[model samples]
Target: MEDITIHEFDFALINEFFTELERQGPGSPEETIRALGFIGNLSNKTKIADLGCGTGFQTMVLAQNTEAAITALDLCAGSIDKLNATAGKLGLQNRVKGIVGSMDNLPFQNEEFDLIWSEGAIASIGFEKGLNHWKRFLKKDGYIAVTYESWYTDERPAEIEKWWLDAVPEIGTIAHNISIMQKAGYIPVAAFTLPESCWIDNYFVPQKARQEEFLKQHAGNKTVEDMIAFMRHEADLYSKYKQYYGYVFYIGKKM
Candidate 1:
C-alpha cells in the first residue's frame, strides 16, 4: 500500500474530486444571470475579478453570460493551468483565465474591478473578513456575490448539528450573513438558497462517479474508502436534512 499523506491529494484526489464539472459548488448559470441583473447597467468593457475561482467553472459561465473582461484568481497553480486550458479551448483566452493567487492576501490594486465575485470560496477567509477585505478591490457601487453556507433553522437534528459543528463551527445564519455584509461596507442586494439540484446534479453526481472509479482502481486501500466517506456522508446528510441548512448565494454592492 502506498503511504499517502492528507495534503498529498492536492494534485491527485483533489483533481479527481472536481474534474470536467461546470460548477465546483452550489450555483448555476441562471443564478449568475440573476445576480448580474441586480448589478444593473454594465457594458462589455466592465472589469471583473473572480476570487478563489477553483478551476474557473463559474468563471467560464461568466464569460459566456457577460462580456466583462474577467480575471479568475485561484491559489492552486494546477487549477489555474486547467482554467487557462479550458478558456483557451472555449476561445475565451482573452476574456477568462485563472490568475494564480490566494484570497487571504489579494495581490491587486484598490478598486481594480467593477465586479468582484466568489462562489463557495469566501469561507476560507471568514465571511465577514472576506467581505471587508475584498471590498477594497471593488469600484464604488460595484457588485459582489458570494455563496456562503448557512443554517436555515436554529433547531436542527443532533447528528447533523454535530456534523456541521465538526466542519465549520461558526457558520452563520442567513440573517447574520446579511448583517455582516452590511457592516462590512456593502449594500445587500439579495439573498437566496441554492436548490437541491445544485448539490445533487452538478457536484455530488460527478464526485460520486469519480469516487466510485477511484475505489474500483484502489480496491485494497482503506484510505481511499475513508476519504470518499466524507463526500458520501455529506450527500447522505443533505438528503435527510436539506431544509435545515444550505449554500445561500448573497449579492451586494460596495458602499
Candidate 2:
C-alpha cells in the first residue's frame, strides 16, 4: 500500500469532485469567493494569485466578476491543463494565466500580488506553512483569503479523529489556524463559519453517490475498489465528525 496525503487523494479525484460541485449548484464557488473578500473588490487595480486553483472555476469567476488579472496555479499538471482548456473555451484565457507549480514554494517575485486566494488547498501543506510561505508574495497591506476546517467544539467523533490522525496527523483545529495566521503577522479581517450543509450536500453525499454509480457501471474492476475505499473513508469521516467539524473562511491582511 502506498502512503498518500489527503492532497494527493484530492488531486487524484479532482474530476469527480468538480462533477459534484456542478451538481451541487452555483452558490458553491460564489460563496467561496465572497468569503474570500473578492466579491466587491474585483477591479483593474487588483492582481490576484489563486494557489491550487483546480479547474479554474473560481479563476473564471474572479476574472468575470472582478477586473483584476489572475495568475492561477496548481501543483497538478492535469489540473492546469484542464484550467487552461476551460479558460480558452470561455474566452477568459487572456485574463487568467495558468501556472503549474507547488504552493509550498510559489514562483513569483516578492510582493507581486494584491491578493492571494486559496480555497480548500492551504491544508495541503498545512495552514502555518501556507501563511508563512505565501506572505512574501503579497504586497504590503495585501490580503489572503483561505478556507480550512475549524472545530466547533472540543468533542471529536472517532472516525473523524481517526481519519485526520491517519491522513494529515499534524493539523490543528480552527483556533490554531487563527493563532497561526496572527503570529505570522497577518491581521484578521473577516472570519465566517461555513454551514455543515455545504459539506453534506457538496462533498459527502455526492461523492458517495458517484462512487456507488461507478461501481455499478464498472463492476469487478480493480479501479473501482480504490474508488470505493476512498469514498467509504470520506463517508465515515463525515458521519462521525459532521457536528464538530466545519469550515472557516478567513481573510487576513499583511501587517
Candidate 3:
C-alpha cells in the first residue's frame, strides 16, 4: 500500500471533504472574535480581504462584528459557493463577497485593503512568504491576522514533530514565527495559542458525523478510506501530544 499523507493527495478529494464541514480547520467563533479585538481602526469604510476562507465561517464572524467591505477568497469553488449562499441567507450579501482564487496569486491590486485576514489556511503558502506576498495588498498600517500551526515548546517527541515536518515543513516555534513576521516587515501585534476546545469541540467532534456521511458517500473507495484513517490518526496524535504544538493566532500590522 502506498503511504498515505493528507497533503500528498491532489486537492480534489481534500477540498470535497472539507466543503461539507462548517470549518476547514481547528478554530471557533470565540477565538475569531478574540483575535478581532486586538485589531484597531475599523469603520464602515474599511476594506478587508479574507484569503483561504473555507466556507467563510470566520468571515461571517468578521462581517457581523465590523461593517467592513469583505472579499472572501478561496481556491475551492465548492467552498466559495457555500460561503456566498450563506452570506446571502444571512442578509450580508452587500458586504461579503466570495471569490474563487488562489491565495498566493491574489486577484487584488497593490495596497488596496485595510486588512487581510486568513484563518487556519496560511500554511498553504509558507508563513513568511504569505506575509510578505500579502503585504502588498494592505494599505499602510493595515493589519494581517492568521491562525497557523506552531510549536509551543523548544523540544517535542520525534514522532509528532516528524509527522508535522512532513506535512508542513515550514512549521516553527512561536518566537521563531514572530521573528519571521518582523523580517517580513510587519510589527507583531499579539500571538496566542488557541484553547483545546477549539480543536476537540469545534473541529473534531463536528467532523465525526461528517466522516460517517463521507464514507457512506464514497463507499468502498480505498483512497477515501486511507484519507479518513489519516485524519483519525491526526486527531489521535493531537490528543496524545497537544502540549507540544498546535495552532496559534498571529496578528501583525503593516510597517
TM-score of every model versus the real structure: 0.91, 0.83, 0.98
**Compared to the true structure, candidate 1 yields what TM-score?**
0.91
150-220 in candidate 1: lDDT tens per residue? 99997888888877766665687899889989999989999988888888887788776678887897798
Candidate 1 stretches with Cα past 4 Å from truth are 1-12, 217-219
* Per-candidate local distance difference test: 0.81, 0.73, 0.93
Put down candidate 2 lDDT per residue, 20-117, tens digits, no spaces. 34332212565665665533345688899999787677778777777788999887677688788888998888788999988998889999998998
| Model 1 residue pairs with clashes | none
lDDT of 3 by residue, 133-226 (tens): 9999999999999999999999999988888888788999999999999999999999999999999998898888888888999999988888
Model 3 / residue 236 / CA error / Å: 0.2
State which candidate has the highest lDDT: 3
State how far residue 128 of model 3 sits from its true place (Å): 1.0
Winner of 1 and 3 under TM-score: 3
| Runs of candidate 3 exceeding 4 Å displacement | 1-4
179, model 2: CA deviation in Å? 1.0
